[model samples]
Target: MSQHTPPSPVKKGKELILDITTAAFEGKGLGKVGEYAVFVKNTAPGDRVRVRINRKRKNYAEGVLLELLEPSPIRISPKCRHAGTCGGCTWQHIPYEKELVYKSGHVKDHFQRIGGFRDISTEPVIGAPEPFYYRNKMEYTFGDRRWLTDEEVQSGRDIADRDFALGLHVPGRYDRILNLEECHLQDPVSFRILDAVREYALANNIPPYNTHRHEGFLRNLIIRNAEHTGDLMVNLVTSGENDEIMQPFSSWLLERFPEITTVIHTINDTRSPSSEGRYQKVLYGPGYIREYLGPYHFRIDPNTFFQTNTHQARALYDVVLGALDKVPVLYDLYCGVGTLSVYLSGMATRVVGVEVHAGAVEKARENAAENGVSHAVFEQGDMKDIFNDDMIRRHGSPDIIVTDPPRAGMHESVIRQIISILPKKIIYVSCNSSTQARDVALLSEYYRLERIQPVDMFPRTYHIESVAVLSRNDT
Candidate 1:
């Protein structure tokens, strides 16, 4: 809890030594300089290392690992070749089991420190069945140049400067690609799809997109393969319609691979380009892919937001269902595509799902009807505004409320609205534990935290998806 101090006068390029002391903000792993906490990367709570000051600030300092004179006991060698470069798995150096412990502790610590909550339990984190190659989706970029390590540059060979693809993207660099042979974070199917795409693009003389120049045939290659069901969706983001090129590629793909049910191409012809919300074109086969979860089948498009780990998603959803405890009337807020409601439609007497996206609401209705579910009703509107007295009177006040909010968690106004309704049982699923903890603290005035389960939805990463059930307490 120490504040950052001004850095001493040192050469800009000179390496300064510091002993790793404690954990800092965002679990960057902290080191100290004369009682001041210096946020350093790749070093844990207790470790000694020589870090070269990269950027000095009055508040904090950024440094690179010049030499690890002594490594921490918690540090483990990363398995992936592109671990540090890909910017995907930041905490891979930490041991697998230890990573869960640290992540869970990190969530609890943030809640206790920031959310003003004292009753939060630091329970054993629920880990994934398969730690490695568990991710069902991976988005690999197509870049012009590759980034090289110091060792490659010191070898007197232009290894990175050569014309090649740098597998995944670097942390901050938009155009620079980090060449990777294999990323263990994804399943073998992901690697296969990536390799095939890279080979096909290279052989066809297609150029990777240069974000700076805004030119090239290829932009992004996103692969999604479900674990429960072997459904594959490949989204190829390009500049514009290239049917002449995509026609043959599509044929070649479907001829050889039947797993790729959906092959899509999206066009982004704008000065300020983005991957989100752009209208995608269906090149071949179906426009969407289907993912089976227990009794429900989820149809996913390119832009749909589904959990990365399909295996653990079942566990997360099960926790939500368990919180309902067979309530007759249930309300699901922020129910994207009505996944939860669709999954629990059989158990509940009637389920009401509220969402913002009109298209998603339509899809949710279609999905529910497809599954022959007659007890579910969906409406497209703002959750806070739609939960009025009229709507409540029609749908009936929910005995159980299940909310899966975004990373920012529920807005203060929405929390107040929920408090006004005051359901018998509340199940909250959150991607950001800090925000969830804050909401829980606010709701603690009316409800008590019953059982909190931390599900490792994204393995090999520091993110945790937690489900907290709160029951109304008699004061």
Candidate 2:
């Protein structure tokens, strides 16, 4: 007898009521329609929501939430008014404890699915002490096109100056900016500074850079605050240098906010939309601020790459340090500003940090010198190009290797080099778990995954930082 296959329960462009049963990776909510999985965004598990199937596939479907028929029991009111709309925080509505569970589960699931590991040891995700007001840096854009919310459009209020917006870009809409009145990611003082700058720009008729025409003055405003030290920096990126505008503006800003320790003016005359400048000039006080992590102090310039969340960075480092023993030599890959090298220098006989950016390598050396550590050295070269046998010989063979690559994760060539070197222990720190799992799978031939520790460096968001410790099989 032949059996007939049933059709899909949901159809493209069709609306249906779905009960979210679980959470999926990347802040998606998972629901099933007749055993067929449906993924919806901006929803929580145990939520009864009305969803419209936007994209249909043979196995699963993607949906957009239309209405929340019933809120989940684990859901809570978001602290920020822009929680659902802003691209900054995704799991704001979910309870923080539940969020940590989801994040930890995500790490385990990645290792199982991507790395093909079944019985790897996984630790509970370490939660942040404070969720809101944790970010040390905030970068805002100046846009001419403001995105209006549904509430604003429904109220029928006459909005003024729709061409001016001084906040973050709308999610999935790079050209449209949402005029944020408040943001919880950074401290309260950041919002105050944001408002002050917006008011000043509107009052003085300073034009925001237009991406389409590539003609305007103001581009981006970046704020950096020291978590341990009470220092603050404000970096203003503009299309051109105009002393007539900046001289008075800096004076007024400093006068208004005396807590602001430094103000920098960066110029980008070209059409590129990058916040980075061609050259920068100090408008007030010093051009850089000092930040402290553990016993070491780091000089943070406008372009310097430092950990965004300061409080949890210490905890994350503690995890790395806990897994280390007194070693003859340690190699830090993609080491920006030598934070890890300096932090772990106390236990290692010598530390070598390699980075691609010349500026970051210079800052790393300066930090090492400032910390009075002569045992650590910073080198400048692309990891794939310089991490070879010659480089390994120049710097003694490392007993242990610690790598903290970017979100894109480490390059395959660099991973191959590490495998060839066969260090006794490799500590992998990554902000993205999927790529980390893939890299670990690639190294599974010679190394055994010892432990995976997930740290919630960023709360109220789906982003997670994980530290994977592995040891050589023979050792």
Candidate 3:
């Protein structure tokens, strides 16, 4: 028997000139090196670049940008100084107008390539109003060791004196964190809070959390602010819960920022970067803050799931509501915190929102109450398991279903259950187009594609939020 051998690695230090066309699925510039697809990082469509081949495979290759021979006309200067190091805003270099074009192309590509949908019409992406400072929420990490610049390290700075750093993560480096002076994506107040908290922790000798050793005082700092309302929430996440230990810091924050409405402290013993806590307590004021979406007012908790971009979320919700007919009953499946369900409660006679997280359901109910939405109620259980005969009887049948699922999209079982229910309309909203396309393909058997609205919820990022409206197809 003959053994199959792996292809030889492309020689290192190899430079190539490539004419790029469109950005690939992985957010890299796609080019051809003699019929072989080569992905170059940080290059945009219409860019001609000199790149060095770093990795190669049987069918494709990856390159790193060495020099720009010709720059794309749509390219512009990024707002953030840390854009060179931080991974969050990759497309900031591209003009916002052109960014929308590429994002639209990416969505249509997903429907065609993944869902195998032919001639699917995609509307132009709804661009963000303000390209900068649109994010209402921002999280900064604490690191015991600071990631130094070429100048900083060469100047012979002592590691111990400048070791403690709290800022954004350096791309692809787990342990390294670049100290962010300012971030353009979030409000300027968030930067002030970041700096203040860092100074306080440094003076108090609070050690930054070390991911490798799993020991430290401070872990993460999260700031949430309202765009419409001036309400702000500051959440200090630590390794453990100690009221006395957090009392001084929380007191200082409230004293410093008179505008801060709420202060929260959460303890997470786990190693993951999640703010989902082992335990939490309200240090000052209420445990949550208020944010408005349309006429409804939502009380967002520390670990609560709220849309990051405040203004764009409302626009996306508007698109979601516009696609559907006024139905008697609405079912919001995989509903985290019931944002959409509450939004639909005004139009529908009865609204039922189902979520797996009990805490989120509690908050959802609170939201419904806050908005005086008496017609809406929340059900807490696994959708696939609880979405049976009894569950339907309890909540009544849904005339229209709106599912805003997680990035993994809906499970096969959930999809089948939804189809079995056979609602007149299905409004699918997703952050991940790839998984969404798969779910759409499954629903295509019973429902016909009606409208595709892609909203740019996250600007300057490769991510896209698309809404698909489906109507019943009676054969």
Query: For each candidate, how many residue pairs have backbone atoms clashing (under 3 Å)?
Result: 2, 0, 0
Candidates sorted by TM-score, best first: 2, 3, 1
By how many angstroms RMSD does model 2 differ from the true structure? 1.7
lDDT of 1: 0.78
Using lDDT as the yardstick, the better of models 2 and 3 is 2
Candidate 1 per-residue lDDT over residues 424-465, each given as its tens digit: 988988989888988988998999887778888877766888
Model 3 poorest 10 in a row by lDDT: 4-13
What lDDT score belongs to each candidate, Candidate 1 first?
0.78, 0.92, 0.86
Using Cα atoms with residue i matched to residue i, what is each candidate's TM-score against the true structure? 0.91, 0.96, 0.92
Taking the tens digit of each residue's C-alpha lDDT, what string does model 3 give over 1-475? 8988654444456898888888876568899966678888788888999999988878888988888999987678778777756677878778888888888898898999999898997999999999889999998889887888665678896665467888888877978888777788888888899999988988888888999999997889999998888889899989997777799998898899989998989888898877766878888887888889998888787888899999999999999888767878998888889888888787689999999999899989988887888998888988878877787788878888999888999988888888778989999999998899999999998899888899998888888899999999972
Off by over 4 Å in 1: 1-14, 21-27, 55-59, 160-166, 254-258, 276-278
Best by lDDT: 2
Residue range 59-174, candidate 2, lDDT tens digits: 99999999999999988998888888868899989989999999999999999998999887589999998989999999999999999988899999999989999899998898
lDDT score for residue 371 of model 1: 81
